[model samples]
Target: MLYHIRCKKGDKTVRTIKEVVGHHFVQGQPGLLMAHCQNDERVFINFDHFDFLDFSNGWAKGEAIVAQKAAEAKKNEPPQPPPEPVINGPGGAS
Candidate 1:
């Protein structure tokens, strides 16, 4: 199952766990230990700094979150200008 972790800080940094390798309790609260699916990186997230954790739909929710982020990023980007028209040489169409 996938897990989404949101930071309680003002920047609100978000991290996604494709798969949780292990977990432990911190002061009776749960903490998740995640390993990267692509690399050797590992992350440990404490329950205290978590603003939100979504595990309801797992994969589906993660996909929705990714799509939502992509849409938001696209919305914030400036409109791109169209390409200039190309002129072909005569010669009956080069």
Candidate 2:
């Protein structure tokens, strides 16, 4: 789940887990953490002087965990073999 944050510029964007905030960090704002999209990798915000949004388990943190698992799963995915070509000739076994 990718997180979302309303940028200081008032534009909403997807966030990444590498964004550092304080003792913790936030990926996106809050309401955009579960969307499937190609990573933009630039929605992270640093609210250093702002109050923390102490949600249970911290949505950003949770997203990090989930994202890690997802990456691992992708890495473990089985490699697909290439398709065979058609061979139409004498003695060709069907």
Candidate 3:
């Protein structure tokens, strides 16, 4: 089961989890939801600040979201300049 977690205020999708297991902790009473991502990464999300989307039906939507995020990241990044030419010793010979 795939799941998408996002920030509620900005609606920005934080990460995509392929297999998810939700855990509830009542010790400190922070109301945190813990999920295990596809890469076996444990992610903690506060119910107050995040929203979850279940993509069990299909991965098309999830893929779309990922694509959108990639596009956004590419757009926001600055272009890189070419590296300077290396100078050799003596008469410019290697």
Candidate 4:
């Protein structure tokens, strides 16, 4: 069956994060599945066995660390050499 994900009412909704928590079960499942939704209203995948706080904190820190590494890499990269002239007058050097 098809389902309707959440919809937004106003422009302000686009700028924020929204979360929905629910329990799901299948016909022969041993236990109900826990579900979550993000602002886009897309269903979030399970965390395996992580608690909510642990997941959130870990995600935030991971993102920060990744960004920091990227920034550091950019800062430490070697500068590019200037392009050589198309024509050289006499000397071997261009």
Best candidate, TM-score: 3
Count: clashes, candidate 4: 0
Instruction: Please report the TM-score between candidate 1 and the true structure.
Output: 0.32
How many steric overlaps are in each model, in order?
A: 0, 2, 0, 0
lDDT of 4 at 57: 19
Off by over 4 Å in 2: 1-59, 84-94
lDDT of 3 by residue, 1-94 (tens): 5555443434666655546543333234344446667677887655544444434544333353454456567767899999887879867746
lDDT string, candidate 1, 1-94, tens digits:
4443333344465655544433322232224323343334466554345555444344333343454456567767999999976768765435
Score candidate 4 by lDDT: 0.35
Query: What's model 2's overall lDDT?
Result: 0.39
lDDT comparison, 3 vs 4, better candidate = 3
Clash pairs, model 1 backbone: none
| Highest lDDT model number | 3
Q: Name the regions of candidate 4 deviating beyond 4 angstroms.
A: 1-59, 86-94
Q: Could you tell me which residue pairs clash in candidate 3?
A: none
User: lDDT of each prediction vs. the true structure?
Assistant: 0.46, 0.39, 0.52, 0.35
Estimate, for each residue in 1-94, the C-alpha lDDT of model 4 and write its tens digit: 1222222233222222234433232223322223345343444322222222122213332343354456567767999999976666766556
Per-candidate TM-scores read: 0.32, 0.29, 0.36, 0.28
